[model samples]
Target: MINKIRLAIRNDLEASAETRQFGSGWISGFLALVASIAGLLLLLSQRYPQWFSMKELALIHNQTIFSFVIQSILVIAFLLALINLVLRRNKILGFSAITLVFASLLIGQLIDPQEQYIANAYALGFDWFVLNLLLTGLLFIPLEKLFGRLTDQPLFRSEWREDLFYFLISSVLVQIISFLSLSPSMFILETTGSWSGFRLLVAEQPLVLQVLEIMLLTDFVQYWFHRLFHEIPFLWRFHAVHHSAQKMDWLAGSRMHIVEIVGLRGLTIIPMFVLGFNQQALSIYILLVYLNATFVHANLRFNVEWLKPFIVTPRFHHWHHGIEKEAINVNYSIHFPWLDKLFGTYYMPPHQWPKGYGIGGHPVPNGYWKQFLYPFQKKKKTK
Candidate 1:
């Protein structure tokens, strides 16, 4: 059965590749240039601090030079390999562009000209980067694989322009909202008070016990937030944009509406605000969410019948995304199987998988702005 599933996946990927024409070498060259520039910046920063002004160095300090370099290398490599399976689509370019932005931010964070080597010492440290990388890989890759499988249908395939625009608009909107909502107290609340309770609760607990408590509490909050989107009509309009995706991949996870992201993150922040989770626990939770959410939506096929009843698996969440009559409004839990089981939203048959997955009723707009304004517009009947 596993071999057959693998064969099916391979065939699907091949079909997708045949339909999509990618510019592999062009992407590789672009990434190579980024890598070279990153390398040069790192070298120059280390070699000639005297040449740069104090402000210039401070700007550089905030940017993560090494992380950018590593990111560029990974992106370039991924694009080269990606062209073999997918079209020379904007999705790959979009990833590269976003990575570049993030890299720039990391660089800025690292290159404190005033502090110089001190900034570099802290900025380029291997420990945090390694932890982040491991966490990201563990969470996103598997989810990407699951999304791939769920989105086997051609209609679900993503359009680059639409996605890129949506992401940009959503991010900007969220930032604006955050700014408007900000105050001195709020700012302090956001940074300092966010995770205080969690820390105090688990301060005396063993490391392993703390980790378990953190995961349980975090997942409990996420599960309800997810279900609320479905149960609440107004919120569903915004979240339906995410469900509109007919196809799923790593980028599928990125297709969320801006408002949805803000709302979800806002809700998640409450626990941090009230509970007082430390930086380390919060970091671990972030890592777990990134990996678990991505893994559940990824294209990888693995059967874990024994584990299914305990922890949420790809098969479990895939069923949530499933388009079948029975699958809709079920499997609301994000990480734990018991949440769904306890709530009675779980719906996996003994020997069945969903034929497809997507929002059944809505005809969501394709462009970012269109979707952003979609909820505001009167609902039109989907064909």
Candidate 2:
């Protein structure tokens, strides 16, 4: 049964809408599978909080709202799976979902009231992963569906599995990444203790002002850092993995090399951390950057021509991934388009997007592991 279910899923992943009709229960089955898996993961995280859950999210674990959420997800999964079982010819997806629902229930029954979690050096961000996935998916999926630039693009577009894997890896390892990314700034701050007065002055400013200052400073640092990745052959290899996406969507931006993620975060965050931005301001900036980055890479078509000059938009960043000759090495800033204009690398045609995305040759191989090690591989020499 397990083997059959696995094979069915593998085949379904490769099948398109043309092959699998819309009313053939596949959509319900897919949703059921997703909910079941999510429910199971949440159950495990609740059972083994020390290893599977984030300490920061501990307060919400036993909350009535959280428990209600888990129950609702499980109920929805069961109903969808049952509906699919009644409607679909193949029972793999439906049966698999039902089996998972039962498994989660079994785990839930074993939860102890006295369960205690010890402090540890490391923990999986499964809790964070679940929340991030839910929040981002709920917010962007609907927007993309209603107003997406590429209306015909399916939710499960080509290479979606690879991008989803990238998203999972980054979120699951958030703890390690945060620690390493911020370590450099923390070390520098500890050594250079004379900047307290300056830092205090910066921190005392209004929250709105601090956020704007953060945007300006970080964008400037990111502008050069992004350009360096394009110009340098070695760095270009790492950055090429990002541009290798043939389709543009919210998930596309997550397809970055871990090295680049660490390096970029470490460098760009130096100013924010060293300058001692208020924690509230830093939190706001972090949220803004998250939304802004996702928005720029989204497959949405908003005619915000007036705002393009002041802030970066989907059109501006799309050109960076454009495969056309004109799009090569342009639009490097994340928040502001003016930096690109100042540096003379900005390229945007009025009322135009790219013919297509990705490197001209599509040199980067598919899959997460291959792309991760691609930069280190020796290139072939043509005689």
Give the Cα lDDT of each candidate. 0.56, 0.86
Q: Per-residue lDDT of 1-383 in model 2, one digit per residue for the tens?
A: 66776778867655677755777788788889889988888877677777777777754676778777788999999999998888888767888889999998988887742245564437787878888888888899899989999998988898888898899988878878888899999999998899999999999999999999999999999999999988888888889889989999988899999999999999989999999899999999999999888889999997688998999999999999998989999999999998988989989899999999999878899999999999888643110
Give each model's clash number.
45, 0
* Best candidate, TM-score: 2
The ten-residue window of minimal lDDT in model 2 covers 112-121
The RMSD of every model to the true structure, in order and in angstroms, is: 10.3, 2.4
Off by over 4 Å in 2: 1-4, 13-15, 18-23, 111-114, 380-383
Task: Report the error of model 1 at residue 319, Å.
Answer: 1.8
